[model samples]
Target: MGSTTIGCDQRIAWLLTSARLLNPDPELARRDGFIKALADQGIKIDNSRISRWESGLHPVSGQVAATYEQALGLTEGSLVAVAAGLRRTFGNGPAPREGALRGADLTDGDMDRLLELIDEGKGTGAHWLRLVGQLGTYDRVYLRQQEWAALSARLVQELAVSVGVGFVRRYEAAAGLIRHPNAQRHLTRAIGGFVMNPDTQVVAPVLSLLTEIADEAAGDLVLRMLTSEDKNLRSAASSVAAVKVSRGHFGAHALPQLESHVVGSLRRGESLDGRLDSFDLAVQLPDESWERAMGGLRNRRAFDLVIGSRRGGELVPTQQTAAVVQRLSAAVQRDTPTHSPHENDAMLRRLLRESLLHAHKPRRHHAALLLAATPYAPAVAKHCQDLATHSNDLMAARALTVLMRVGHRMGRSRVLLQSLAETRPTIRARALVNLGLNPEPIKPAEADALLGHLDEHSRPVERHATMFALGMNGGTTLKKLAKSDTEWMARSATWWLDQGPALHDSDAALDQIGAQT
Candidate 1:
């Protein structure tokens, strides 16, 4: 629990061992050789210390993580990211999910199957449509060069003039893929091509994509496009990537230009640009710049790699983090500001509100997560009443999500219950998924109705997600489903039952968890 406390994490341990064994330099791969390499980097660790890390008794982080990556010839931030990202999931704590990852975790087998699935479906248009739709939900993936070349082409081809649902699904899925290293190269090119393309249909969608995966390369590409004769292109790029002239690493060099917007929004009590957030600034700029931007926006864990370094920060949040966001809440409700006597509390509330107002749906949805992870009291409910009914449907839904999550803390479910009547599958499913968070007692009729509706849902993925919600709200239906449903669902149900009951607001558990990823 101490900041410097070392803990063994199974995933990081495996990755460390694999990196060393696979190294081509025999000396570098040997235990003694690896130690010498670290020593050369001025990391004074002996056999016992190195063994401690390799054996999973300590997690390499901060400076040590960087040294490990460099000594092993892996990319910088690689090891650090694995450590920060897993902190929330595989912490050295007593909790149900504080263990190693499971079926949801991606492996070589999963990637192999997915690549084959893409190859098999490439010939059929209907199959490509379905394939991309499904791929959108995946946070991490590996694509062969040929497959990425093919898929990236298809994405641009489809999205260049897409309207409504097709645009939303493909664009979002591609943005989600930014988390995987291999996918980012091809994905960036696809987005960059679209940015240069003059198609009006994709203007909004392109900006949305840029916002989600903004980085130094992306910042430079968009900035260069600003001088084009096309008026629409100029307008869209400027709104999202506004920055003063800069030469190298446009994002970092021009951090002040981009951060001005965030600071102005916080100071003026206005919504932040949908395309940006403080986390982006933190990753792009040096740690010393943190105080200057927004007069010092500081998170206790800002230096953790996933939340800090450009490499780790730029990737889509790891898949586990993405999956958890999907499970947060589905309800809608009214207003109440969290009356805090503390100035910092007031500052945090302002930050959360403006962030929730971001035009980017995913960023807005993250507000619920920010709240869930902060150790605030239960009084903060439906605070962003204005946003809950915003014209953007996703925005409104996300606002409702914030309230529903807050209501969970309050042991109240009015907004959550009200949302269940929603006719849209997305809406209704979200409500079902969120019901797992509400601690209020559910009537037998209500619980049965939830189970019945969950069983009847058409999509297998949706059904699987609802199973998680139901498991969290364990009752007769959970017990019944533990013995029924598909083998996976039944097994998942049984697992959830043993994971213990859902958490209460008083637990103060989510604080310091999932803020970065």
Candidate 2:
């Protein structure tokens, strides 16, 4: 092969690397499998060729390169990325002009031109499939600093409302940008703009991206955005609400992901020192569904092992709660104790009792649930109240969460709401979340009282909940909430309005209506 063939080997190397990144163990090719398979094909390539491909040795043959490309599902010109990588690595590089997205300032005119250029016969599926392919291409070139601003801005304007699936494509493109160190900062800012745009109808796609990339800070950013009072923004953030509901479901199917995600975060090394502030990304289960996750039949043995065994609290042993929860819950229910059941019972009770005594300390779900299920209410309520006031925001959120769950059962929501009304803004924010999740119906008048909070508070969560409650309750309040600033609530309100008149004549429905005047 001539020196012109250099890019081939690098391309092969990149393909191999990218595949391994996605699936470290490509089961189809174990030790010597590639060589043996090639031998069977009468190709008789040296092991070095395979090793070179893995380690990025010499340029591969056109035939072999095509085979690798097929196996990897690489798009056209993907090998060019190897050249891009080489330029990035060795400093010998292609001219910036060769691969840069030309005509960077794409206006409506440019977009229209492209639209007209495409054959209209491209069906929806083909369009999306092509878009996905194009996205991978975009990532290879568009992530760099000078290149991204123009490309991203054009993309945001062009694809923002084209289709929901396109938004997903956009996000995948963004993820590609994120992986490239040279382009990440610019792409990050661009993504923020794309997501925050009020005119963008592709909120779900953006949200899916946000969640995929969520870390402590990113999760907090998402939580803040999801509660925004802006109707358009909130509506766009519905993906987040759906995610929240899913994470919190604790359903049989979701348990494993939750354990691996949520419980694992808590027991991670950082958390052992009590330094972890948020488990947003770490946990897949919602805060509300933890009890079901832990207490469910499938989780019993794992639950027993964690709470019963000395090794339970340790980080590594219970890394993925899903499998453990399922296995343990199954085992415990089968009456096959991993340890002595009586001893486990005693230990749990003792832990519950101890939690009550030091109720002021930040408590985990197990400790809180044990207290809630305890025969004692006053003690539980007192600690719950303390948690509601705790300086740590997440702790306060969790505290209010436990209180709301057990409070209504004890007929204490009125008291809880009364107390919440006087709490700090941070605590009040969580309180509103609890109130919105309240199972009991409030009267229209009472619901109005909560709805009235929309005008008084600036917090997004509070406003959203107040709107949700108002929508749930009917009459003039519902109409007003439909026009509310928060898009999420407005959508909900609109939905309720469409459904409410049909059910209006039912006495059961009227009784179920928010407290009447």
Candidate 3:
């Protein structure tokens, strides 16, 4: 079969006549009014053009044919046929098919009915929910706002906190409503009131309510206000608003909210000169499986947002980005029980790079901590160095603890040895005692260095931490320590080593050691 081209002038005539027939309100295409409408739409054409085609005085041109097709929102072939039929029936009066109506011709009453379905409380919430689920339905303006207010509230009131959060999040995502600042303010206030109420019992329900409002404003600037400087408001808001970024369907929305809460709290703390304590920095991932999936993504937006919050940056003043990074980094360190391998890998890589290069002290400190805890790998080596060499004694100490942890995870004695070597004598001795609890074989020189701390250092805590590290490093090290100027260090190290993983199976061994001896 071959394709046939339709003339533009004839296509325009058919389109105009067809529009008049389909328009229940006859004013839509009255006489030359349709041509004027086209002209108003930036399409240049006159009634003569239609008349000529209708009279068969001229064939329509291709450009005109395309213009008419787009202006009428009709398929090219459909418009061509309608034009041909118009030419054939001009003298016979307008074609019968010209009077036919599309669904767009629904009367005012039909529109009312559709709106009623959406606003029907318990009856319509699920309906709109299902309606929005259908592809392309979200683009319809009338359909989108039809029952939004009522449906959104009901969903918040009905579903479990997490479920409601997910559903509303999905809806707002489809509608792309998060960018509107006005909507965000109204939404934040409405939902924030519910969730921020200290008397609320069921966190899920309250969380659901806030989640509902947040959906309308998932990406709004109002998100930054959740943890604002009102001392009472921040303390009250942290509980309900505190969220974790698990990897999956909930991730796209939940992660942003989580990031907002973190930054908000951090900024509040900074404003108070670091007096504010309760920030809800803890985050619980769904499971180990999710870690791999969630951890692998860079979260560059969140990262950049926090980085800019640090002093001297390009982006908008988004609270204190460094504080936000520290809060998140602290959560990753203290809270995550597990993350998927992929997510863990990605998170570790980014954290190491960011920490090494970051100019901010608090953010760099936390980043170094996260890197220290991560398993030793080539990509992360620089972060370990940055932490060890850090000017802040506290940060360097924390980094050393993490380095040992990473070395332990990798089952690499060399990394542990080098990490201990990089530390100052006091720090090295302290670290050695920590190693004794999980002691791998240490070099004779390292053992001697740690032993010297036992008699030389007055701080019992430092001496004990070094002794523990030495015992855990295993070998004749602790027995060699038994010959120390004071036998208590050897005895303590030996006793702890005997207990091994069983010393405090219920709690963390390092924590137990720190507390006990």
How many Å off is the CA of 484 in candidate 3?
6.2
Q: lDDT, candidate 3, residue 120?
A: 53
lDDT of each: 0.46, 0.40, 0.38
Pick by lDDT: 2 or 3, better one: 2
Model 1 lDDT tens row, 1-517: 1112323354455456545644557787678988888778656668886676666655554345445666876533334443433443236554222122111333445445544544543222222323433454466655578778777755555444332223333444455554346677787786776566542222544554555454668776666655556544654555445222211235456556555533432343222222233333333444445457635433233333324324432223334233322222121111222222222223233325433433333333333433432223143444433344345454555555565534444434554554455554444444554565566545567766655665444554346436645665557776876788477567767766654444331212212111111
Tens digit of lDDT per residue, candidate 2, span 1-517? 1123334334345445333333223432343654554456444657665676566455433234334433443332223323322233223333233111121233445333333323231122122223323343443543345545755454433333222222223333444445454555555566577666543323443444443343444445555564565544643344343344333422354334444333433443432112122232222244445555454324343344333222232212333323433332233223322221222333233333223222212223223333332223234454555556556554455556556434434434643375347445545654654454344555666765665555544565455445534443346767776787877667767765653421111112111111100
Tell me, by TM-score, which candidate is best: 1
Is candidate 1 or 2 superior in TM-score? 1
Clashing pairs in 1: 136-173, 178-316, 179-316
TM-score of 2: 0.30
Over all chains combined, what TM-score does candidate 3 have?
0.27
Candidate 1 residue 68 C-alpha distance from true site, Å: 33
lDDT of 3 by residue, 1-517 (tens): 0011323233344344433433334444364665766677666667776666444345543234334544554332223323332233222333323211111233455445534554553222223322332312234343244245544444333331212113222333223232233233333443445444442222332332232233434323224434455443444334334331211223445554554445444444132112112222212223332333334334544334333423332122423334543443444433333222223333443344344333332233334433332222222333443455555443455445444323333334533464346445445532453354343456788667655544554554456456555544456666655555665665655554453311111111111110000
Ranking by lDDT: 1, 2, 3
Q: TM-score each candidate.
A: 0.32, 0.30, 0.27
Sorting all predicted structures by TM-score, with the top scorer first, yields 1, 2, 3
